[model samples]
Target: MNSIGNIKPFLQKVIRSGVGRWRFFAATLGLLVALVIILLSLQLYLNFNQLLHGKANESETAEFLVISKEVTAENQSKKNESYFLPEEIALLGKQPFADRVGEISSTNFIVTISSFSNAFPFYTDAYFESVPDEFIDIKTEDWSWKQGQVNIPVIIPSFFLELYNTGMAMSQENLPRLSLEALQAIPLRVNIKHSGGTAEFVAHVAGTTDRLNSVLVPEAFMQYANKAYGYQESKPPTRLVLKTLDAADPALQSFLVANSYTTNSDKTKLNKARIIVNWIAGVVGIIGLIMLLFGMLVFTLFIQLTIAASRMDIVLLQTLGASPRQLSGYLMGMFMPVYGAMVMIALLVLSVLQYGIHQLLLQKQLLVSPWLSVYTLAAAALWLLLIWFVNKRTITNYLKAG
Candidate 1:
């Protein structure tokens, strides 16, 4: 108890080191705060960025191919045109390049569509197709159709609309060039002629996809719609949607060439903005790490300066029977409050910033977690431990050298 009582004087002296040398204290505090903010903020950004990108699947090697047999004069003369049999799909599954194979759910059933407005007077036979949900690049939440759902959601090729705008609509006085958004809003009445009766309902454009060049419906809806309205076929699909792990996989091209199967001309379109965001995060992270390292150096220097200023007192204390262990502990305690304050303040500020950013994302219809992720919290703890370890080591080493 008497030893503890005697140690208070040394503790007071160490704490008083920051009183006159306010510059060091303030600089250390500010630099550490900057370090923590930059480090944590950039880390948080990266975590959320990855989560968001994955949620959208904006670009993580999802390549879809609309593969159909190469039309040939000899094959065209035969009764059996071409179709992807179950065995062919199994063969594709065995290939090293293809990740998945989905039969393109296309209607052998007949379909005729007409505009609800007689002013448009548009009527034509349109083929409906649906690739698996994995193969479509469009958002799927708005792309479904049920018995009572608002309208049958359909995805059509972008070029099909471009053709109508350039060739069909330009020649006709009644038709207007439709944008994707406008086309999605407008409804088309589909009439399915079956068994001397026609069932009519409205179809809405869900979205357009660059992956496939044909009209698309949800696979579930295709089964229902066809069963209700068209003749059943025993034959397999002539068109298939191939899901490949890598767009640039050499085996994919070799197989396609070998089988004489063709796909859409567009290969892959990675989101340039996502790529730019990732690069920016990497650069910011590097800068933050440098600043953090500099902050640690400044803090270490602060400890050495304090020990130098109190060199005379330390010598007198040791001469009077105080040990280096007591001095190290006292110095570490002096810096402890600073570390604590920095952590609390940094976390508070980071929480507010993350909340604001998350709310902004919410407003944009992109949902992400508002709280700091486990990765950020774990990183913060590791950083704090590093600071504590370095500060303690500086005090112990300085005492030993003295």
Candidate 2:
């Protein structure tokens, strides 16, 4: 405390001069450079992890494992040969790597789709399927179904939408191409027919998924419809959706091969995308490290020059009975604010940048996760410690020579 008081007057006079403060401000620039790199590094790390462990059904990281019985002569003898036997499904459940396995329950009745608020413009024969909600990636408040509610919510495959727009809509001039936004706006009607009669329900498009190649209804709704309209009450599902811990898990492929199961989508493509993302992130990280190294070098050189410029003042203070500890404390007080200011400035800039990025990603229906604030704070603290260490060492060495 006394050391701060001793140097207050001199510090105030020196700080008032623009020329004298130039060196300090220049030192802050190095600090700023270092901070920028660290901020970018944190961002790169977050993006890498998001892509690496992204959802199985997301566009950024598409992961769908649809397993069905392999096409074989022996199995083709039966009408519905792809069905997994009860014991076979039980054995699959025992594997440690399989996250969750759900049956793809098909509607045992017929479904007819039509549009309201417009003429009966198009017609298509469609079947509905459902799985447990846990296997679904796109979560929405509207993606739900109850027994009494007439309106049914459903998810459609992305490729089917593309096919409709490109193949059917393009060829027929009278047919209108439907965009996701447009489809959600106009209401739809779904007719579920049973042996007894037909029931019409209002329908809407909740969302779209790249994984499931079928129109999906809620699990509860599927169960209700099947019970009401199904010819066979105790029939087993022919297709299954397996949610695994990882796409690259060796055990998954080995087990699939052993059971002669076939996949609807290629898992190898996802593995390749992950590899490409890793390479890009690694390159970004290396560039940040290089910038940080340059920052350290600039910081050291600036401190040495500043110390040499003020050598005479340090000597005179020593002659006036100011101990080395007092001089060191005084130096720390003078520079600590600059160090602290740099950190504050850097954080402010990064915060604004992060927020801007978050907004931009949101517009595209994408997500950008924030970095860990505590981790960045720890890094900044270490940087401050480095500045303090250098300041003390330079002062102690100069004082020893006197």
Candidate 3:
């Protein structure tokens, strides 16, 4: 109880003296720290995200080729007539490094979601959640990114609805079931008349990549459409897609050459480029870190100067029998308000930066990970601790010098 009474006077004296004349400098130091933290956080996020996407794309490679000519038996006799096919090669990629054997198929078309109109609606039947404007798509393209989802969309039969006991029974076992909530919120509506008397298919949502207003269907639907729509000749694919299991630099190159197939070295080049880019980014991160450290050092020096200017008063306390423990606690306590302000300002600044970046990505329909929030907060706290320790050392040195 007596110790508590003695500690109260030291705390009061520190608080009263610490907030003396340099209020503006303390505020400016804090603001600069906040700004530096924000910038570092944003740059780290951008670079990290870029690396993730680039690495993902790099793992799966697809070979694109255009057929220029075809040889035939009749051409040996006189000059056989040559014709072109409409199908394109699509290879679903598998293991990239050790086992490269993959499945190959022909796709009628690549359904890339290019852009969307003003009203983008949600799907009720989809188990996977959708974020507005995110680069998520349901594609017939054979790639790792396009797998795992049911791409072949068919009409939600009345029978499917009946299975759920919604009283719209048709045939429970034969039809595909979807939620009525999703059906009502369908994103696209268009009549696709088939070529050979097949039923016209319609969709609730449209693909965004193509300016074409229709929702994309699978190869079966396209074939059905061609027969009904009177497409005369079927287009043959130019080349077969090759998948390799060995992703080693030398092995990949050798495999392509041995097969007499030409491939672009772009993926290899990009990986190398990232090494340099990441190094540069790391250097910039370090520089920002140094600036933050320098700012804290300047603030600590100012605090030291303040204490030195009041050295005579400290000496008077020592003469009055104030213990060394009391003097140390008083000086450390003075910094509590400054450290608290710095931490709060850093958090506010980082939050605003994150919000702005998230909104920008949302408008552009890009993927933004929420994990960035956790990373930024962790980094800020780490820097704050470093600054606190440095300030402690500065106070000790100042007292010794006085």
| TM-score (all chains, Cα) for each model | 0.54, 0.52, 0.44
Ranking by lDDT: 1, 2, 3
Query: Is candidate 1 or 2 superior in lDDT?
Result: 1
Worst 10 residues of 2 by lDDT: 11-20
lDDT accuracy of residue 206 in candidate 1: 84
Candidate no. 2 TM-score: 0.52
Q: What lDDT would each prediction earn against the true structure?
A: 0.74, 0.72, 0.46
- Candidate 3 deviates by what RMSD? 16.5
Supply every candidate's count of residue pairs whose N, Cα or C atoms clash at under 3 angstroms: 0, 0, 25
Judged by TM-score relative to the true structure, which candidate is superior, 1 or 3?
A: 1
Query: Candidate 1 lDDT, tens digit per residue, 2-102?
Result: 25456777568544573356786677677766666565656566655655445536555566777888788878865366788788878987898678888
How does candidate 1 score on lDDT?
0.74
lDDT of 3 by residue, 276-363 (tens): 5566667776666677666666677667766776777777766776665566556766665667667677677656665676677668
Name the candidate, 2 or 3, with the larger lDDT value: 2
